[model samples]
Target: MSVLEIRDLHASVQVSEDELKPILHGVDLTIRSGETHAIMGPNGSGKSTTAYAIAGHPKYKITSGSVTLDGEDVLSMSVDARARAGLFLAMQYPVEVPGVSVANFLRTAKTAIDGEAPKLRTWVKELRTSMEKLGMDPAFAERNVNEGFSGGEKKRHEIVQLELLKPKMAILDETDSGLDIDALREVSQGINRVKDAGSTGLVVITHYTRILRYVQPDFVHVFVAGRIVEEGGKELAEDLEASGYERFVNKVGA
Candidate 1:
């Protein structure tokens, strides 16, 4: 199994005219294939920042430390390069593209990642199957990419993309937000399908333990003040739900 490693990761975001506000401070974690790691924290604790930094977003600059995917420097790769190299980021708020249909967007992504367009006949079958797995309507494929989609619909669409794209590593930022109970179960099942593949490593960033109940994590990390303050097994999530992040926040002096 391959591992994605983050060593002493320190990142900053540009704020003022010439000032940078430090966000992540020395975040270190390793995720191996076939394992799910949950990053749980409060609002403004820099959980999203870590996801963006790992995906090489220009808004967050890595001042020190390294992010490596099986010994390759992920920081050196362009966004598209990172995607093609098997890194996937499912955004908290998926954006809208008015003109591009979901089918076209997904096919284009598959072509780019696989270095060749998949067969139209078989690709359609695969696409429909993926959509069905996510409990999405067959009509969703005809809609514009995330255009006017409800919160649950948008998230389910992302999960469909995740299933079809099949990236080696997935970073899901707040996937549970805005999901109804049914949608949450559907989305969690879709994620578990991907996890069942046994070749992808997953980092699920969430604020609550509800989602963890469906998509169990191998490791539960308590993130406070831009860093992981504590880590343990699935029971940690239960404890957090009962105790809340107050102790962790206080310990970090955040």
Candidate 2:
């Protein structure tokens, strides 16, 4: 089984030319294949930073501690190397790629990760099938990636990659942001498709619990002040929905 282990992961985000703002402070967590973990926290509590750090985002620097995937050092790998090594991060705000079509983008990504291109006939069929399952029109295959697409469309495209690439570990950074209920449910179903495969580890980072109801997590971690303050099962997420992060914030302050 695949394993992702984070130990005392301390990191800082580059704020300016010369300043780095400390974000993650001695964070520790672990995810095994087939397990879904939710990282919940208040705004600015370093939830996104953790995802970026694990994905080797250059903007987020790892000052100390270690992140490893199946005994290999993750922090040392380059961004592309991280992806080829089976780590995927769906950004909070996906950028628009003006020239690249969705079909070309997904095919190139799949080829890069697999170290070879897929058969043209089979890839096309699979691409259309994935989009249909996500409620996306097959014609979107010709549209530029996230260019002029709605917020829901961009998020759905991210999941399309998640399905095609089949990464060993996926960190969804705020997949539910800006999505209406209908869009959210569609995206969650796409995610559940991967979860059902039981091969990829899932780390869902968000401030809200709505998505958790659809993509129910096996472990719920309450993050505060750059570290996890409490952890429990799915019930903890329900409690957070009812009570919110105030108690966790106070516990951190205490």
Flag regions of model 2 displaced more than 4 Å. Answer: none
Kindly provide the TM-score of model 2 when superposed on the true structure, using C-alpha atoms: 0.98
lDDT of 1 by residue, 103-192 (tens): 999999999999999999999999999888788888999999999899999999999989999998999999999999999999999999
TM-score of each predicted structure versus truth: 0.98, 0.98
Query: What's the CA RMSD for each of the models?
Result: 1.1, 0.8
Tell me the deviation in Å of residue 244 in model 1: 0.6
Worst 10 contiguous positions by lDDT, candidate 1 = 12-21
Find the 10 residues in a row with the least total lDDT in model 2.
51-60
> Where does candidate 1 stray beyond 4 Å?
none
lDDT, candidates in the order shown: 0.93, 0.94
